[model samples]
Target: MDFSEKPVLTGDRTVLRPFTAEDADTMWEIVNDPEVVRFTFEPSTELTLDGLRSWYGVRTADPDRLDLAVTDRATGELVGEVVLYEWDPAARGCTFRTLVGPRGRGRGLGSEATRLIVGHAFERVGLHRVQLEVYADNARARRVYEKAGFMVEGVRREAALRGGAWVDGVLMAVLDHEWEARARTDATQVTGEPRLYTP
Candidate 1:
């Protein structure tokens, strides 16, 4: 969805909505977290509040991507974010990524948030495929993606460098029809946390 009309997606545990300037503070804390940095970005990456503010400030106005803040519905607090970017219009595909901070981990909020946004991507955004890459060592993140219906397609050997060691990046994707099939099954079964997260 575009900035002007982005939808607020709600699930049993989390809510996904367009990012706000106020979210930058929490996001800064989340992004700088040791676990977050190790898994999602490089340790050498430097971030600043002003830069975060400036970046998030304009996210809603951007026409090409969908970036949403993931919030815990119980406390109405910002937990993390989920994004769909690198869109290929002709292919009807896009890349997905998500991160959960220390405050929101271990409660299955990330999984629920992923299901919500990926659902919106296929049903509302008219995307045919949603894909992502996760480091093989990040089992928690990969489990969340798998529970949300993404299947591992292959691995990119030594796709990322972490702590001076190369890490494999696992590629995963879910197609529209696969999501629809999962939806039908989900409707028939009682849905709950597949397992506790250690995030």
Candidate 2:
């Protein structure tokens, strides 16, 4: 989707910008990290620079997908990434996913980055809903999503085989109304302005 033309989103510690071929190396590093890919769906072989570049080509060509490179705003260092996947134009909803490198872990970057992306998805992209499927054992990620106001809607028992054992998957979602209400509460607390949730 012409992501280069999309507005970059800024947060307290990070910036979300369009992903480019130049980011291949950074992505390769993270995607190959065993700890980083443990609970995720990344391929085991580890992506080579050439493979990443080719993947980037296909990703950038898809109009419905939005892939962003997460960077530390203060140092301009690549920290992680966020993606909005399986977008449904008619339904105006999509699945959200995120990953952080080792250096970016344990710093609340995941939660903060998610908040920023959720805001963009609802307020800027005009999406009706955002959803995600997280590994049941990934408590940290589940907490991040919960703190961002996504409700646990369902669970798939033994949905994936990880670490030589079956694991459940939890489905979470936040609707536009929920996001709007949260935004209103935030605005009222910060600016003393009354806001309403319209959608």
Candidate 3:
């Protein structure tokens, strides 16, 4: 599985494309959203625009990880990001994570983005497994992951402290065979097939 070639994945509701320097401001706003920060990042963490610009500017140059911007298909607005990092070449697996800002919440954009990138990981990149850790209290995100074919494997007890309370981190993963089976089933059921890296 190679992360060197970042592709644009197209789904029904969203598009996943490699990040550019221009995306830094929008990403900063999304990451700073209270709801987004509460679930995905430390509440007290501070991020500067210059830092974000510098970071995003080189996303495509990083060969070890894939970081794609999640954009609304209809309006072409940046919503969030879907990332696959901490690559294990021998295991052919990586960690997945995503965050949607308020503008894209409750619209199934995040779910579609998740499916698109995960599909690319297994189908095009030849990855064996995709795993993620979701805070147990975030049932909504868990549901999204489940819908995308990730299954709960275990839990890290008290993995994070949020708002003065310890939150458990639920581990989830989807294997390549499992994803392929689900894709074949979806195709038989007439569900939308994911399209990636369209020319």
Candidate 4:
């Protein structure tokens, strides 16, 4: 895992790149969105603008994590972030998390960002697995995770509370072998070649 050299990962619709303090403006929107706040964090949690600025500023210094801003490829506007953190070196894996602001939602940017970052993890970092947890009620995010090759392991029932209601968190993960197969499938769509038998 080479954290020293962060790379800009591009996809059809979105680009994932290292963070800049200027992107803090978008964080304001993301942290305040009802859906982002309810699903990603405790409903009562508050994010001060100054706090977010400091948080995003030091992302590059962390040697064990990767925090990249997700931006629209065409507009170059910051949408959200795709992060690989909480690293377990012995396991050769890390926790994956992402979110898209209102401006970037409902357009497949989230899914594409998932694929771009996950691809970098498995292919470049040699991680054995990448895992994430989505609230059971957040079906949209679960679907996106599923589409990106993450399979549900189990439910952490009543693991979180939102609006005074307990919500289950669905644990999902993608393994190295699974990523390899997914990569082949993605390539097949482009070249129409059955590369499954190559390895």
Candidate 5:
């Protein structure tokens, strides 16, 4: 998980690349969306361009985190960002996070982008597993993770407090083997291709 090396991943509708200080304004706009930040622990606030730029500088310098900017290929519009955090070489695993703007929601961009990231992690980075914790209330996000082949491994009752009430947090994970099997199944459905990777 070398953060210094940026990987360019192109999906059907979007492209993911390393985030730069120049992208601060775009990132600010996306993260400031109340709906986008509702389920996450981070606070949503309006950031001055300078403040965002400074933050990006520090984040991009981190050596163990992979933070990518999601962009629409056709329009070259900055839509959102996805992050893989807590890279551990010994464990060969990481945690995932994502945020997509209002205009980018419901188009399946999040799911597609997630699939691409997971593929890159297991195939390119040689990670054994990728995991995420999402609020049980975020059904849409949970569905996206499930579609991408993550299984719910555990649940923490009343783990998050949102909207003045306790909410459950679901822990999900997909191993390298599980992802390979899923890719094989998808390839078979799309082109009658034989399985290439097995769990």
Candidate 6:
């Protein structure tokens, strides 16, 4: 659960890094965006500048969670955030989630950010499992999770109310072994490294 060291993760299309206090104004807009509100939180949720400032202001100090801003490398704007929280030390696991506003959507940035942090969880943090829940209707998110090797566990019926209707929540998880397999495949493909995966 050590969050004192925040690392900057980079991809061709996006960068996942810690936030600065000056990012509050932009992040406030992103966190309060209607799409972000509907998907990642209760629809009735709202935020104020000071509130968001305080929230982002303390991300670096939290001992039990990792919160990193998702920056679209193309535009150099902080489009959203990726988080790992609810630490279970006994199980060496955590829950994963993210937000990508209009600026970052439809470009595969979400999936890239997910892979970056989840890789960190396994390769750097020594986590055994990572899990997430997405509304059944969010096919995009489901696909993203799939690309990251997260297998759907089951359905949580009527798990949430969004847009005046109840939506099924799809529970998905990826164990360290699964991720290791994926990582090995990725490395083999990228660097033409010998694939003697014993995991």
Highest lDDT scorer: 3
lDDT of each residue in 35-80, candidate 5, tens digit only: 7768764443455778879877676677798888888877888898
Score each candidate by Cα lDDT.
Answer: 0.87, 0.81, 0.90, 0.88, 0.83, 0.86
For residues 1-199, could you state the per-residue lDDT of candidate 6 as single tens digits? 5555788988878989897787899987777777777778876666789888888888888778999999988888888899999989899999999888888889989888999899888888899999999999988788999998999999999988888899999999999999988889887987698575321
User: Model 4 segments beyond 4 Å from truth?
Assistant: 195-199
Candidate 2 per-residue lDDT, tens place, 98-132, comes to: 98898788877778789888888887788899999
C-alpha TM-score for every candidate: 0.92, 0.88, 0.93, 0.94, 0.91, 0.92
Error of 2 at 149 (Å): 1.1
Q: Model 6: runs farther than 4 Å from truth?
A: 195-199
User: Please, what are the lDDT tens digits per residue for candidate 3 over residues 1-199?
Assistant: 5799999888888989999999999999898888888899876677899999999999999888999999999999999999999989999999999999999999999989999889888888889999999999998899999999999999999988899999999999999999988877777566455532221
Clashes of each: 0, 0, 0, 0, 0, 0
lDDT by residue for model 1 over 72-141, one digit each (tens)?
9999999899998898888889999999999999999999999988988888788899999999999999
Arrange candidates by lDDT, descending: 3, 4, 1, 6, 5, 2
- What is the Cα root-mean-square deviation between model 3 and the actual structure? 2.9
User: Each candidate's root-mean-square deviation in Å?
Assistant: 4.8, 3.0, 2.9, 2.4, 2.5, 2.6
For candidate 4, the per-residue lDDT at 124 reads 82
Cα distance off (Å), candidate 3, residue 39: 0.6
Query: In model 2, what is the error at residue 177, expressed in angstroms?
Result: 0.4
Which candidate, 1 or 6, has the higher lDDT?
Answer: 1
Candidate 2 wrong stretches, greater than 4 Å: 1-5, 42-46, 190-199
Per-residue error at 19 for model 2, in Å?
A: 1.1
Off by over 4 Å in 3: 191-199
Q: In TM-score terms, which candidate is top?
A: 4
Q: Which ten residues in a row have the lowest lDDT in candidate 4?
A: 190-199
